[model samples]
Target: MKIRSVLSAAVLAVAATFTSAQAFAQDTFTLKMAETWGPNFPIFGDTTKNFAKSVETMSNGRLKIRIDSANKHKAPLGVFDMVKAGQYDMGHSASYYWKGKVPETLFFTSMPFGMNAMEQYAWFYHGGGMELMQEVYGAHNMLSFPGGNTGVQMGGWFREEIKSLDDLKGLKMRIPGFAGEVFAEVGVNPTNIAPGELYTALERNTIDAVEWVGPALDLRLGFQQIADYYYTGWHEPATELQFLINKKVWEKLPADLKEILRVAMRTASYDMLVLSQHANAEAWANIKKDYPNVQIKQFPQDIFQAMYDANKKLLKEASASNEQAARIVKSQQDYLAQSRAYTDISERAYLNTMGTVE
Candidate 1:
């Protein structure tokens, strides 16, 4: 009887160990997130790292994210395709980067003379814009979250000041997405070059001008060093960055883990926008101190107006031809109308009154 009892106890112990091992195996997850930006860039890289950290911490080590920055795994522009193909679980990118896949993707990135960062966020979160954007991504077998926003971008860095319409003619610029379309309309040839090639392109006269994120990232990339003139009038009033994930991978996440990812991505998105705005403000001041020779000019009113007109026309034309484009634009336009109506009464008035104070 004593020998039988001891054997039973050992059998129970082995069964318990097997159950424990199974539980531990179910608890850990490893995911890959990809980005085109170098790991050293301030907001993009740092934000990506924070996302991974947030997921790991929120999961209490149950999930781990490995960020593949720059060309660590694949070329940056292939982020969306890789995520869609399940090569990478997620991607951080500008929706416009994949504009070739879906011409309408540019609208999700920016609209010239369109909403600012805060208003765009409001439209996405509360105005149903997010759902509409997801609809576009859904066709690509992906889902996207608003990952970041560069409040208002500089028109671009030009080799020379653009003082008149004539000045823009024959200028070859490294601009992308819809703004590139607008530039083309205005007689500037726009080339879409990868971030890694921008500096060398600008240096070698491969491109006469280039527009990048803003003072923060652009200055760091040394664009200001190669280009003499910086023009601003919101070529891209607000540019939204996106995080895309394979739909299958997203669906497979445990419910709790999915919620955590959503919350973490949104938090990181908001934080990145606010941080970039502040950093750009500081960088502007620093640029003046260090590069006094740099010419900073508000784009001439006529030039700004012309470009705005071209962009508006392009938007109207694109929406009419593409059903998906029309849907996203209608959603965005409706939100903008409602938002502007409310803000005109409060925000616009406050700003006008404040301006008169001094």
Candidate 2:
């Protein structure tokens, strides 16, 4: 009789364990996401929309993400703060935007002479980028992930051609991130402006130049019509947007759901980069065909040299003050040096060869 009682209790405990596991797997979650972009804002907006839909679909309705854009929240630049304070469960914005709050955050976006999209994404995943990013944001009670990538960005739309470094002095330009600091080092007055206001800012002389994404996005703002000189890209190569999640909120998610969110974020990010390439290519062709007046210009060698030197100087200054920043810089420089070697030999060499042949 005693043996029978022991066996019955054992079976009941196993049943209870199975039931708990089932309940855990079936748990439902609906997370709220706040974005920096306004509603229906092209590729950037599509990233968030795709991610939300993917999360729900992949999890079979166990997880859902509801997104609110800048217009809804009335805080275009408040994503980090809102998510950190738990006002929002997650956020979609660029890491560099949080430079004012955490200096190390800027490195996660893109540097002036940084790696290209392929190389940078490798660094983020295979390299130490993810660990470094977590260390920086961990103190702030948030977890940040690579949300999307805009590959290489154009220099800016300038009202006048930058004939020399002198032309850069006192120039009010709507530029952001670490590149802005580099521009400031070269005597340009760097300012940040929301996307919706860029066209008016330039037309009214509120800003002298604007460095937006690329042909795809810049064309939408009508910069080609007003700014006659469309400079080629040099500042932001592999500009990466980030997804922010509150630490408490992240911890509350089950293991399987956490993995689902990660896969969804990564997939959406890669898709955005592909979309950027297609859209930029299409838009560039259109600009050449329809907007012949828009002249594509590259900065003179001397101007490029000056900005390059200034970028180095600014990086040195940044490293001197903060150990964390110093470590992050070293990691990126080390990785860049290693990977750029292969890139030059392979990608760069092939492109050069193809250009000469065709």
Specify the highest-TM-score model's number.
Answer: 2
lDDT of 2 by residue, 1-358 (tens): 9999999999999999999999877989888999998899999999999899889988999999999998899998899999999999999999988888888998998899888999999999999999999999999999999989998999989999899989999999998767888889889999988777999999999999999889999888899888889898888899899999999999999899999999999998899999999999999999999888889899999988988898989999999989999999999999999999999999999999999884
**TM-score of candidate 1 against the unseen true structure:** 0.89
Q: All candidates' lDDT scores?
A: 0.84, 0.92
The C-alpha stretches of model 2 lying farther than 4 A from their native spots are 1-22
Model 1 Cα shift for residue 83 (angstroms): 1.2
Model 1 residue pairs with clashes: none
Which residue pairs clash within candidate 2? none
Q: Write the residue-wise lDDT of candidate 1 on 1-358 in tens digits.
A: 9999999999999999998998865667788888878776688887888888998999988888889887586587889889989999999998888777888777777787777777788888888878888888998899999887777888788887888988889888998777888888888899988777999998998989998878987888887777789888476777888999889988888888889999999998888888888999999998989888788888788887888889889889988889888888888888887787887888789999999987
* TM-score of each candidate structure, all chains considered together: 0.89, 0.91
